[model samples]
Target: MRANLKLKFEKPLVLPIHYNHIIQAAILKLLSDENYSRFIHDQGFKYEKRHFKMFTFSRLEGNFLIDKGNKTITYFDGASLQISTIEEEFMKYIINNVLLNEGIKLIGNHIQVEKVELKHMDVEEGGGRITTKSPIVVYSTFEIEGRKKTYYYNPKEKEFEEILRKNLIKKYMAYFGKEPKDKYFKITPIENLKESIVIYKGTVIKGWNGIFEVNGSPEILKLAYDVGLGAKNSQGFGCFEFI
Candidate 1:
């Protein structure tokens, strides 16, 4: 069983926000130039898709703790929908209508309070080296409502998981100021393919005769293929050198 990964935060009551406002904030933040680009790239890496189609939505309802001795100002809760497809505009429509709005009947219904704040929680799962499960599971807690989420792709899973993970990170970073740093996520293939399990986007590799293979790794080979490293063959690339 996967362990439950969670985080929590608290704020004093000063102001209240209607559910619609939170949705708008999320949409505004996600569509921003920086956030969108990051979201796109991350999706690209995860889905291995030339283009990324994404959509998400949430519905929230909670109470703010109002007490001089206690500090709980705002509450947030919502569900999410993510999809990847070749049709770009179709995906955008879903995000704009369903995911962004969560079908909120009234934008004005947002309850305003004295104070405002946001809290966040995240669950993460990682898989590598079946024999070694030391870090297969990682749990991180956050103090703010905003936080980033990252997902590592397993070749065995459906094609879209990676893309979703990357975009999720972009979404979180846009909300939070910091991004999580994990050595596992940074994994790029090592010089020798036999020993390496994964490769990164911009890895540098040496081809045959110690020359940089112009075409890069071959795409057909099961073990090693074209990424940042370039093309390759199954057994060996004719005694090529590696970085």
Candidate 2:
């Protein structure tokens, strides 16, 4: 299940651009500490490249234009928050309770839930990889090695199809707890893909933002769509939506 949430702020707020971890902390607040750690973090690296987080979210959308000359800033009225999970119970519990005690305090400003739009798509049993309608996938690969290197489509390294397929298989085993029927998948890029970067944790973290059609296991595809794709999903990378 997924929720399109609009957060109304009690007062205007400002913060550094690198606020992914802070948003992650707010998401974990929806669940119990044990569950949060178990599902969102500290998932034993028992597997090769899997982490505990089974969900991903979109960037906060609101006013962000800064006016340095005036020494003033315009704040956004609200922000849209999209949260999803693989399990039904998890989604229901979090939605019903995330706002129970008090609203989420994001970036030192308390935000109230103004609106919510719930969406759900279930993969039928025996469903295969490609569905009747294809979805555009945009994912940000995690930083590897000592430096941040991001790639959307680097033909020099390898075809995007091969890279995405290999990563999806690992994610399938890690998140779904089973090997995927198809070991490989394909990503047909619909648009010109390129590399991008963002300031996270006070460093230049490489990333990719583009769209593609995923050809793989239907169940795994849905899981990727709902939860996220690639590594470091909880830290906000790889969850995609229809373009």
Candidate 3:
């Protein structure tokens, strides 16, 4: 399930350039269920040794101005954000909490929930085209000289697709408690593949934003649509929309 939230502010909304963490914090705050919130935050659904929050969100969309000097972005108009999750319970809590609250805070800025729209996307057997709502992130970490270093992959690399496929498979197992019927899945960039660099909580995350052709099992495709593609999904990466 996916929810598109339209937010209004009495004054111009000012935020730092790296505000993904702020948006994440606001979402967690809106959860009315404290236990559920803590669970998703501290320890999500576990698969093997990995944890999957089973949710992803898009970057804020609206008119905005970037202040290089102050390192901030100010939104003159209202903003819209898309949040998705495979867990129905999480979606329910988000909607209920949003409707119940008169207003919410986004980095100390009061934001009114103007509208909330829900959408369910259907994936066919052959799959179809998709455009990223947030950049798709795929990477691996390594230890060198007792120091941890991360390597981010571009879409053109073979490892990028391989890692994404493996990630979807793991997510499938994590959510369904069994492997998908058909494990075949592939993602290829169609056009306008651009690298996106985002700094989340002081960590530099490299990702890609573009339109792509995805061919896979309908079940796996649907799961990717709901949970997001690639890695760091719960941190606001890999959100895509069927095009």
TM-score of each: 0.19, 0.75, 0.96
Q: List residue ranges in candidate 3 displaced over 4 A.
A: none
**lDDT (0 to 1) per candidate:** 0.26, 0.60, 0.90
Q: How close is candidate 3 to the true structure, as a TM-score?
A: 0.96
**Positional deviation of 145 in candidate 1, in angstroms?**
44
Candidate 1 residues lying further than 4 Å off, grouped into runs, are 1-22, 25-58, 62-106, 118-157, 166-243
Model 1 alpha-carbon miss at residue 79, Å = 14
How well is each residue in 1-243 modelled by candidate 3, as lDDT tens digits?
A: 899999897899999988889888888887778899999999988889889999999999999999989999998769899999998889998888888885567877678989999998777766888899999999999999999999999999999999999999999998889999999899999999999998999988999999999999988889999999989898899999887
In model 2, state the lDDT of residue 125. 47
Ranking by lDDT: 3, 2, 1
Ranking, TM-score, top scorer first: 3, 2, 1
User: Relative to the unseen true structure, what is the C-alpha lDDT of residue 37 in candidate 2, on a scale of 0 to 100?
Assistant: 46
Model 3 clashing residue pairs (backbone): none
